[model samples]
Target: MVSDRMNSRAALWRVAAGQRGYFTAAQALRAGYSYQTQRYHARRGNWLAIDRALYRFREFSDLPAEGDEQLVRWSLWSKGSAVVSHATALAAHDLGTANPSRIHLTVPRGFRQKSDAVILHRAELAEPDVEDRAGYRVTTPLRALAEYAADGEDQDVLDGAVAEALEQGLVTRRKLLHAAQALGARAELGVERALGAML
Candidate 1:
């Protein structure tokens, strides 16, 4: 026979599985773990405390987290309102030489946040601008390029991103050209110059 305790643990495991073995205290509550039980698990080493309200199964502590896991952690931190963008998105798409020192996240125009680990861009993103990644959201390569050009990043960096994205077939030339034109002058010029040899 199955006990309710077993059922609750199983339920929480299901949720944790989807989050790389991580979960929030509120999520534990929804999985039938009371605050007292949550405390007990943390103290007993069944759960590893990650932040003020975040945790992961202790079993996951022994292994290294994947790159995308950072995205998930930040997405969870933002309560799923952030989309990885800019140089980070460029790297995610594997089309640039950008080595972003901080994670770049795009949040709603009204969103306000502060963190040394992240650089937040505020915009009301259109649906097509974002793409659902493994367990998080990221700006599409097209959107990423437009953002990079608009940000006026070093021209050399922009050229590298555009060239790699085109050679790797990550974005169609016509689509990229269209995206750049829509973003206005400077962006269009960057894409144009990058496409020089390819054109």
Candidate 2:
């Protein structure tokens, strides 16, 4: 029979071996353990709870602590169909500021999640309209910029994002113009013009 210490070690190992650092209480429980047990181990320095049922490896496991990027990643894990959008996607494209506090996530119209940090947008996504950003798949550069510009934030921020996007070669003038035209007369013309000026 396995001792409590051995079981705790095994559970910790499971968390260390997986690509995911976050695990729900139900997941830990289903893995032949209890949530309280996991908590006990964490209290004993065998693990570190991130948030909710989410956890990370103990310091001795040599695993890095889950940081903002990891939280964003966890948010993605929680949202299987979510695509990075708006400012989050713009940042991913290196077209805007970095490490936004409120991570923007877009999923299909009916998808939802439990995260409050995520600014969720329900929009239709075409397969070709997305791309892999630093291993996290997100909306394409042009689409991301367009979405942010349309979000009705300060127009200057949108212009800067579009400018950076063009400077980084993540988007083309023609693409931006076409997208603006599609968005019609109500679209932010300044941001579109910024795109045009760059190309």
Candidate 3:
């Protein structure tokens, strides 16, 4: 008979495989496995911890290629409040050349962080300012650029993001000013000035 530990590990493996190498403790618990048992197996080399509260099938990484699903899973660990922002957002919008070293996330004020790879910031987001992009809930292009400005993005980056916003007609100077006021001390005049130049 397979021992309970082995059985739980098998279950974890199945779930992690379905989730593209990443599964959270809550997900495993929902799958009729014990979180503590899963941790024990991970310590024993049966599983690998990825992000905080996330585990990956160790063998999955040994495979020859990466999958879009893995990126999606990492994004999910951030919950719905996070938007792929900063350098990543610029890449997404095709507005800049800088590649971010970490996964930048513009999160709401009260959301908790669950991953070391995520660089999180607090922001006030309105419902219409957010939309789904590639299975991740992200700030709209204009809102993302504004948030980037609020977070003190460099002049070139700010200019690129603002230019994209203007091209898309998603933001106006009035909108940025309102957002800047809401951003308060977190707002950077550097971003605001660049955005003004675009206007």
Candidate 4:
């Protein structure tokens, strides 16, 4: 019995280590923790509740909350469907003058997580439009720019993003044009104007 308990604890640690010390209830169950055991751990202060279904190892409480750690946590809470996007993606790519007060996440059409700290957009993102950054999924530079333009972001910020992406070779005129066209008329026109100004 003691060996089984030790193995379970080891498995849980392995899962939590990769997720900034966080583990979901589903993950806990998969790691051999019963619901009653989870409740006992929380009551004993061995686990810190991050949300309704998420818990963190108290032993890793010293881990600094920096960089994309929070984003990764939220993505895991979202069951791996959330993709960082919009102004947040622009900031991630270092291509725009975007300063978003809230983290932006793009999920699939049926996603439903409501939180004031996060702005969630629902859309179907193709594999090419998403890229992994710092262990978190984020929209590509071109997709970020197009989404920002579609959302009616500041003209100056959009322009700066275009110039930076072009200069960094993160995006080309043709790719930008294709992305803009995919967003329809207003976005296409805005991206065109930004590209024209850069040339």
Using lDDT, give the best candidate's number.
4
In model 4, the clashing pairs are none
Per-model CA lDDT versus the true structure: 0.84, 0.65, 0.66, 0.87
> Candidate 2: which stretches are off by over 4 Å?
1-20, 23-37, 59-77, 98-100, 133-135, 182-185, 188-190, 196-199
Q: Comparing 1 and 3 by lDDT, which wins?
A: 1
Q: Candidate 3's error at 170, in angstroms?
A: 5.8
Q: After superposition, how far is residue 85 of candidate 1 from its true place, in Å?
A: 0.7
Question: Candidate 1, which ten residues in sequence have the lowest lDDT sum?
Answer: 59-68
Task: Itemize residue pairs with steric clashes in candidate 2.
Answer: none
Q: On residues 31-130, what C-alpha lDDT tens digit does candidate 2 reach at each position? A: 6667678778668876666776666555423655443345345543553577777777767666656446787887777775657767888878888888
Local accuracy of candidate 4 as per-residue lDDT tens digits, 133-194: 55379999999999998888688899999999999999999999999899988789879888
- How many pairs of residues in model 3 come into backbone collision? 0
Q: Could you estimate the TM-score for every candidate? A: 0.87, 0.69, 0.62, 0.88
- Write down the TM-score for model 1: 0.87
Q: Which stretches of candidate 3 lie over 4 Å from their true place?
A: 1-20, 40-47, 58-81, 86-88, 111-118, 133-135, 168-199
How would you encode candidate 1's per-residue C-alpha lDDT over 1-199 as one tens digit per residue?
2587898989988987787888889989998899999999999988988776788888766778676777777877777899999889988887778778999999998887667899999888899899987667999999999888877787788888888887788888899889989888988887887777456
Residue 164 local lDDT, model 2? 75
Per-residue lDDT tens digits for candidate 3, residues 1-199, read: 3586567667767766655666787877776667777778689976677766777777877887542454456565874457666566665666645466677777778886656676776666677876665446555666666666666757687776677667777677777667666656555475567766766
Runs off by more than 4 Å, candidate 4: 133-135
